[model samples]
Target: MASTWRTRKADQKTNLAKRRSPNIAEVSIPTHFRCPISLELMKDPVTVSTGITYDRQSIETWLDMGNTTCPVTNQDLEVEDLIPNHSIRRMIQDWCVANHSYGIERIPTPKIPVTPAQASEILSGIAAASRRGETTKCRELAVKVKAFAKESERNRRCFMSHGAGRALAASFSAFAAGPLENSKTGVLEDILSALVFMHPLDEETAWHIGSPESLDSIVLILKCGDLAGRLGAVLVVKELVSANGEWVEVMANTKGLIEALVKLIKEPIFPQATKASLVATYYMVNSDVERMASRFVDLGLVPVLLEILVDSEKSMCEKALAVLSGLLSCEEGREKAYEHALTMPVLVKKMFRVSDMATEFVVSALWKLCKNYNEEEAEEGGRRGESLVEALQVGAFQKLLLLLQVGCSGSAKEKATDLLKLLNGYRGRAECIDTMDFKGLKRPF
Candidate 1:
């Protein structure tokens, strides 16, 4: 009877022990389960070429920071060297489940990663659908591509490596050639959004997108599409135009392309859109300076650029000045600039206040205007001195003198000196002296 009573007592003690919840800190986790890099339990273990396993996040972060060697083994490692260790991940999940009472949660099984082959297959489907004129199907496949890209950085890299950019550019070119209706706008937007995922496009892909049909489609989107679509279109244009001079010339001559870009600058939907439009315009005008500048000037680009210079931030000021400088290379551009009320004053204000680049552009533009004024004065028997006098009226002399006082780039220093001589010629004029601030004036030399 005493033996039976002892057995019952032991059984009760065991039940009580099972009912009690132990603190997680008391559990001894296996060392092998921890990632070598993070020294924590590996959620998604991956083996590298060095035959060492690490948590995927930990090693990817290491590689992204430009380390080409394995953290544990010091062997050369590349991103493609990573291989998922499924057995270890499953073991981790099982361990967490068994330790549930200690507050350990089981890690969910990870989805199979995307591969380059899979990305290429989806792109092939898109191309086939585009060829068949199945707009809806093309859009669905594009969404799938975009979904894959959005899933992870690995997936994006996979898609980009598999010619996703060229495929999407072809698909865009195909659909954009059709009639643009509300239904088609969704299709185009999906394609454009996916294309944006494949950015920093290769030259071949850019060549495809720089076609006349693609440019016309981009212009339409810039005019009528939603904000995201417009931004994507402008950004794509910016990238394509930068690819080659031939593309730049093509974009410059495309009907309504420059006008659409200028409109975006005039009524900016966002800062990036405005900047991208400015960059695109700069490239287009710069390609064929004399002809392209006249086209942009006809679109009232000069006044809009002047407005950006007057009120926008430093970066915008710099880009606006760049476009203005290119535009000033043509006679028509110079005339438009001279006619604008804010041109001289705004240029003077931006000097040394924005950046070295901005100062250079400003000096170049002013030199053009003053030089033109001198030519006109000689041709028209010295009657067209108003622009030169206006430069002095806005304190151009003082700014130029100060620029010379401090220092500037080689080209800017030369332009500033020439401008000083021009302004000095007009210094004794009544309009200049009346508007000049003489207070605290001192010669730098």
Candidate 2:
């Protein structure tokens, strides 16, 4: 552990350097948002003397609720982060309520495969070679790492997990920044690929997060402000928590994970579509539910996500709708979801807007969202309270029924039937059933 005096000494030296510099520093706005508690222009912008100042109050709320650090600062920021910038607190409050998702979710980066072990072994060998002044060996090792990362890309591979991928990517980057690079596009491409692989995309594949080594690597990876790298990492952390079902006890350990995940909103490499997708995805990572209903909720995510949900691009729409379904699922499970859910309506209208593969993925996502409400939450299966049933009653029911008619295998047919049966058992469900005309209801025991 680092000692306090050491930390203080470093802080003092940093202050001295800043004071010694000829130019005064510029106030840093997080490039991301207006203030939340008070949505004004976030005037009381506090850039720490140490050069890291996030709105303390916002960071504090996330932490006092048992989070470990500020999502923006990755600092030891706790409740003190909530110390309001008294000057602009009111303005910040207004902005919080006014800002919407700008109709974009920076999409999660495209995924790649390179194994953590493979990347690690190669980077370590290069680092050792560099230390020994063996430029030849270092260059050779970098070549191998780049080649392997490239090969994994060719396979259109999904990463092992976000943490593992990022850790591996960080190591690769250290090698690239130090020993590799010559203004060549090929070298630049390798760096970019490594960036994507640094953190796997959310649900690009299932997240496997029990590995301590992978987690450690993830912490190292978050140090670099490469926007794409951190965005991928956040999705992995958020999705892993999502995959864990409601094990909030296991989730407290992931506060560091959340901080890394939220930090992406401040970076530039994040596009409007990708950013919206991430907020929708990560916002759903709260212990049991997504925080969409909170008074302090980040509403800036909504409009952007809605845009992608309606996009003409099949892959983009598929991902957007998947995030929407996850968001809608959380809302639907509770009766309160009525005020916030727009996903089902948008989904129904855009149902036929894409390629069959993308359509299949979206339908599968919708199915899982419904399935969780039906099968997993059984005893609490107040079908009346479920968002899935509510969606069925509105407009999306026909689209789902249409999906059932598609020429898929018997298993797909069976799953759809099972979901239908769950909704059918609910109190005002007959009205929804009346909307679908699939008459061949053969009972599959």
Best by TM-score: 1
The weakest ten consecutive residues by lDDT in model 1 span 436-445
Give the poorly placed runs of model 1, Cα more than 4 Å off. Answer: 1-58, 61-69, 75-113, 147-154, 177-182, 375-384, 430-445
List the pairs of residues colliding in candidate 1: none
Backbone clash tally (model 2): 34
Give a tens-digit lDDT track for model 1, residues 272-366: 98998998888888885448888888888888888787678888999999999999998888888767767776787787788999999999999
TM-score for every candidate vs. truth? Answer: 0.75, 0.37
- Candidate that would win on lDDT: 1
Model 2 regions more than 4 Å off: 1-125, 129-224, 228-252, 262-307, 323-337, 355-394, 409-412, 415-445
Q: What is the lDDT of candidate 1?
A: 0.83
lDDT of 2 at 263: 41
lDDT of 2: 0.45
- Tell me the tens digit of each residue's lDDT in model 2 across 84-128: 343344444444433322322222222333445555566566446
